[model samples]
Structure formats: C-alpha cells, structure tokens
Target chain A: MKYTEEHEWLRVEGDLVVVGITEHAAEQLGDVVFVELPELETQVAKGDEVCVIESVKAASDILAPCDGEIVAVNDALSDAPGMVNDDPQGDAWFFKMKLDDMSVLDDFMSEDEYKAFIG
Target chain B: MAEGGQNGDLQRTVLHDLHLDLGAKMVPFAGYAMPVQYKPGVMAEHLHTRAQAGLFDVSHMGQVILRGEAAAAALERLVPVDLQGLAEGRQRYAMFTDERGGILDDLMVANRGDHLFLVVNAACKEADIAHMRAHMDGVTVTPVTDRALIALQGPLAEAALAALVPGVAAMRFMDVATYDWDGAALWVSRSGYTGEDGFEISVPEPCAGAFARALLARPEVAPIGLGARDSLRLEAGLCLYGNDITRDTTPVEAALGWAIQKVRRRGGAREGGFPGADVILRQLETGPERRRVGLRPEGRAPMRAGTQLFADDTADTPVGTVTSGAYGPSIEAPMSMGYLPAALSATGTQVFGELRGKRHPARVVDLPFRPAGYRK
Candidate 1:
C-alpha cells in the first residue's frame, strides 16, 4: 500500500491510482459516518483540496494528493460511511484519478516512509 | 457486573480493540476511550447520517434494571413521568429530581413486564444509581454495566434492521423488543438521540465485538464516531444533556415541557409526587420566564454556544446566551438555539448574536432550523 504524509493512500494498479485515507488518520478522526465525493471530471492537482468528510464532531476537507481528473468516487459512502474508518486503506477509496504527472508520486511517502513520518 | 477495572482512572470500554481495528480516532469521552470521528471526518459524517444511516457505539452509558412489586411506585417518586401508566415494552424519557426540584439526571425508563429498565447518561450513571439505591426500600436497582449499546440511526435504519429481525420494521417509535442475531440477545429499541428514525441495540458486553463486527461487515453499515453523533443531533435540534439542558435549566425553559404528558400534570393516574412538580407545573400553567428558541444568523459566520445574544429592541443589549449552535448542513445556514426572555422570543423577532467582537444580525424563529426526519 502506498502512503502520503497527509496519511492518505493510493493503491496503484498500473496507472490508475485508487486513493483513500490512512489508518492513522482514521484512528484520530474516530468513527467514519459521512462522506461527500466530488464530481467526475473535476480537475484536481496534487496538493489541491477536493471532496469532504465528516464525523459526529467535526468537518474536514479531503485533500487531493495526486493531480488528476476525478475518474471515480465511492458512492457507497452515502450508505456505509464507516467504510472509511473500518477500512481506511482499503474500501474507502475517495476518488480515483490518473495522476497529472507521475512525478507527483515522488512527493508522497511509501508505506515504510509513512510509518517513520507518523512516529 | 464486571464494571470493575479502570485503566488508572482512564476508562477503556470492552470494545477498544474493535474500535482500533476500525481505525477509530479514540479520545476521552465520558471517561471511556471512544471514537470522536472516523476517516470520513465530522462534517461528512453529520450530513451522511442525515441522508443515510449512521451507527454509534454508546456502551459507556449506564443501564439498570429495577425489580420490585413497587418498582413503578419507587420510580414515580424520583421522576415526573406517569410510571404506572407506562406499559411493558414502552419507554418514557424522564428526569430524576431532588426535593427542591433540581434535575439530577435525565433517563429513559423502559417497562419490561416485571422489571423496569433504565438507560442513564454516561457521566451521571454512578450518581443515578447511588441516589436511586438510597431512596428505595424494597426496590432492587441492578446496574447492567456489563452491556454494550449500539445505535443505528437515520432514514434507512428500519430497513437495515429489518434485514436482521423480520418484525423490527413493524415497531414504531419508542417501542422495544429482543432480536435474534448471532446468538446475542439484542434488545432492540426504536429510539435514538439524533431525533431520527433509528434503533438502540443492547447486547451482552461479551458478545459486543461479534455484534459490532457483524454490523460493520454489512455494505450499508458504517461506524459513526461521537463527532457525527453530535452534529446529527444538533441538526435535528435535539439538545445535548449537559450542554443544552442542565440541572439549572427546566424542561419548560428548554422547550421540553411537551414531553410531560398532560394526564400526569393533574394528578390523574400517577400524581402529586416526584420532585420539581411544583415549579414544573407552574411553568406549564404560567408559561416560562425564558423559552428556548432557534436563532438564524444573517451571515455565514458560525455563532457557537455561550455566545451572547442581543435584542435589537434593547439597543443591541444582551438578552440571551447561545446554548448550542452550528452550521447546519441540512439547513445550509448558521443556526443556533438558546434561552431568550419570553417576550422577545417570538417568531420573526429580530435579534443579534455577538460573534468575534462584532454583532451579527439574527432573528428568532420556531426551533429546528432544518426539517427533522424522525420516523414517526
């Protein structure tokens, strides 16, 4: 699993990067209750903020880690928001994108690097 | 009740491991390591539950079962509700009181044939038991501290639950019954704090993990932390026990006097007892000195609780304090509720909320800034 300093992950399948929050971030945010996915075709630059997520206590914006056109969003979040909490690195993919530039991948930490950064 | 073992005064629930597995953001809530938010964040959690379903693990709350022939009579002495009239399988929201009518705690009393089940708030559970135990002679108050509570709330709650229990869909609001789920004796109740259609399931603490896992396994089920729970209830215009209603605030002033059934007021079936009956009855008769009302800010800036409210008619002088306020996701406007002097608490009455060293235009309106979708 690939990771970011922001505690997000992108499971890469060749060129398509599926993104979601990391377990550490999920642990701090608490229960995954609600989610909002941005529209498809929305342009998002790496480091650009898009989408939004909420728990019972606070609201936060889901930042876009990689620049790409929004290709897909987890629509199931509307019904099962806890997916983001229970499986932050797995089923809770916020949006999928074809990275704006492959080099933006260099800015993110690998799973090993992420563990050290969090500590 | 194995309610023993405190992690050096840092209380941890039995399902702490389960919460960690789910990546819950654990924090100190009512003395337990509880989730405040999840990966989806608080705002999204709030809105999603309003539109869909959200599950909350509130097992930290205290549960008690009162046993005795005079159990209802003992309860009536402590609370204002007509306990004798409450049939089995039904619940009544009532408040424990002192001789002087001070609210000790708010609770839900459920009649389970021979026994009365009481659900008390987490922070005040110990005090409730102590007070109840001291007052009763024959009544035996057994704390069901070994139980875990899970609430599945929202419009889809009934459907999701019906998939587990075939008869649950037929249960209306405030009803309760046992459900068959994975060998766990789940006491399912059509009740929730979010003011939405939902169910509160009580299970044996030992089986809580399995039950939670089963619910989490469903594609539609998601774990909702405390953050979303607060926002959802706030949007629904439901008051938080401590933040909104306290010992100092009366039901009438908090706009909760309607919950007091009229039959109990005139000493009909259960009467002339319970603390605060005099002051509570007076409020019902003469109306309240101050009434809880909703405030709508003219600007997008959020006005929070404790923010002073000013009446324009009084040259913008302060008249109230915001008890609870938030940017209502459903209403799409900054909404607040507080106790305002009765005369100025009318609909369309213009007012202002002091926000960040500046006064913002506001108006009092009929509460519930957003339409509540409670399953009737």
Candidate 2:
C-alpha cells in the first residue's frame, strides 16, 4: 500500500490499484454525505481531480494519484456515503484504476512516510 | 479546512476551555474561535438537538442594553417592529433597514421593563451599535460585554432547563424572565433559532461556564457546536444573517414580512416612521420582484450555497442563487433556501441547480422543511 500527500491510499491488487481516502482524511471530513465518483473507463492524468466528496461541513475533491483509467467504482458509496466514514481504509475503496506503468507506484510514500508527512 | 494562521487576531468566548475539554473542533467564525462540532460530529449533534436537547455557546453574539425612558420610542426609528406594543418580558424579531430598503442587521428586542435588551449577530454587532448610536438620540446603547449568551434548544429543552431554573417551565415561547442561579442573575428568553422549544440564557461572564456545565449535566442536554446549530436552523428555515438575508436583501424579498407587524405597516398608527419606509412599505403592499423559497434537491448530493439556480437545464443566465444548503439530519433529505423571481417561486415549481457543471433538478417547497416544535 502507498499514500499520497492528498491523503489518498493506493493498494495494488493483481494488475489494478484500489484508491480510497485515508482514515485521517475521513476523520477530518467528519461525516460524508455524498460522493461523486468518476465514470468507469475514463482516462485521467496525475493530479487530475477524479472524485468529489461532500461532507456535512463542506465539499472536497479527491485527486487522481497517477495517470490511469478508472476500471471500477464503488456504487455502494452513492447509496451510503457514510460508509466512507465507517470504513475509509477497508471496504470504502473508491475506485480501481489500471495504471499504464505499474512501476510508478514505487515513487509514492510508504505508510510510515505518509504518517510522518501528516504530522 | 479549519481556521489558522490568524490565531492571535481571533477572540475566545467564556466557554472556550469547556469546548476544548469536550473535544470540540474549533473554527474561526465572525472573528471568534467557535466550535464547529463536538466529538459527536455535525450529523449526530443535529439529530441529538432534534431528539433531545443541545446546548450552544452563542456568547459571540452581541448583547446590548438600550437604556433611558425613551428607548422603545427611539428604537422605533430604526426597526420596523411594534416596540411600544411589546409587553414587558416579551421579545420580537426585528431588522434595521437601510435607506435603500435593504436589511442592515436583524436582532431580537426584549422589553426588560427598565430597558430594552437587544441581541444582534456577531459580525454585524459593531456596525449595528454604531448605527443605533448615530441615529437614536436620548437613548443609551450600552454594549454588554460582561454577559455570555447560551442557548438550550430541542423538544426536551424545557425539561432540561426547568431542572435548573424551575421558573423557566412556566415561560411560554418568546417569553423573557430573570432568575437567580448559583448567585448569578440569568436573563433568559424562551426563544431560539432551531424552531424548537428552548431558552437563550444570558449569564454573567464569570459564571457562564458553570451554568453551561450545569445544563450539560442533565442527561437530555449535550454540547452542540456551530455546525449543528447551523444545520438545525437551516432545517427550521431560519435565515443566517450573512446568508439568507443580507444588506442587499429586503424583508419582503427574504419572506420576513411576517416579522413586520401591522402597526408598523402602511395605514397603521405608527406607520412609515422607520428607515427605508418608502421602499419597504411599497414592497409590502405591491410585493417584491424576487422571493426567498425553500428547495429540495432530487439527489443525495447537496447543492451548496452559491450554486446558481436556473429556470431550466439550458438557461444561459441564472434566475436565482442558493443561500443555505445542507443535508438535514432530522428531515433526512438535502434542503436549501434560495432566491428566485416571483414568477418562479411557487411551491412545486421545477428548477435546476448547476452542480459540477451538471444541472440537477430541484423542487421549490415551502419555507420550513420540518414542522416547528415551539411550545407556543
């Protein structure tokens, strides 16, 4: 698993990368009321905004970590956005991305590095 | 993101340490470090307020005393409420109008027998004080800095508060009374913004924390933060000073005409004596071009404030703009308040709110999304 400065976590599963916001980010957002996920199969570049998370306080964007194509999205989030707050790191994974170069994941921060970065 | 960088410039209320102890997420509001939510978060706090009781630290709001024998008559020259007709121990909602018929600030005026007690918005208090002092003569506008204001609101508010002050149980909605608690004189009004049966207690600054802790000691009462307070008021269809009603919005346009009594209207005994009487009264008779209306969006996604409303999906120009929008925890739906042209402001009218470059359908509804639980 790898983390980005934007507080998103990426885990490699076979050839796909599952993306979701970290528990710290979810805790900061309080309660998630809505989540606007990207369309399946949409191509996105690094740093491009891919999803929008709306909490009771305000709305925030989840940027794409690397150049990839969205392969699958968690439709359950559309029905129960609160799941993001309940299980941000586990079942609340936002989407699965097919990265063009799998080696790009090595450049991201490790779990310890991300924790220190948040501090 | 939470407020920082200007920490030195922000002020703290009397309950600051208490909020910190309760694990409140403090945020900057109107130049004060106010708690936006406690450990329960906004959703739970909102629901808790509706289900039981929620104590709010509203000390940041400006409390003032208008003294002298001619205070009521002098105040009549500013707001459009029937101040003279207001009986002692009663309060009325009023707004100071500008020369252009726009609202300068909205406040609560309570007749305290010896003087009038006014509670104005925190952001507009300084300007409101200056405006009152500049216009009204023979009346002393004394800013009360030694008092802290706290509101206990909910369906069980009376039960929780009556436990502390037995006299509060006898007070009806909008009734004001003075009571002694722990050697402190508490000026309490049976009024709140949550549309619930509640009381706003003005306590001496030194004892404010103890008073709040006493209320919180009750099983029905919990400390709610500014975030839940906002959502509760929004669900109740009440206006935030800077949001729903502004200096550019009039009483009629903001659907606040109900607050203006007949005695202050056209052809009444004390008509046209207040500021912007010409335009406000004219709008009162003929109606304004735009009107504030409640909205229910079609989806779970909230069409937040500043979202432009159009007549349809393809309109080039917006017909209105959302002022307050949130997911109402009690109502279990996304509700909003915004302004629209009179022709398109009817209930059930279809409108489109542009969000994320897509036009989402929303229906125009009546002012309050939920029924008020006032004890009146």
**Per-residue lDDT of candidate 2, residues B1-376 (tens digit):** 4434555679999999999999998888999999989998999999999999999999999999999888999999998889999999999999999988899999999999999999999999999999999988999999999999999999999999888889899999999989999999999999999978899999999999999999999999999999999899999999999899998999999999999899999989999788888989999999999999999999898988999999999989999999999998888889999999999999999999999999999999997899899988
Model 2 clash tally, residue pairs: 0
Q: Estimate the lDDT of model 1.
A: 0.78
A13-96, model 2: which lDDT tens digit per residue? 999999999999999998999999999999999999899999998999999999999999999999999999999999999999
| Residue B30 of model 1, lDDT score | 83
Worst 10 residues of 2 chain B by lDDT: B1-10
**lDDT of model 2 at residue B353?**
99
Best-fitting candidate, scored by DockQ? 2
Q: What ranges in model 2 sit over 4 Å off?
A: B1-5
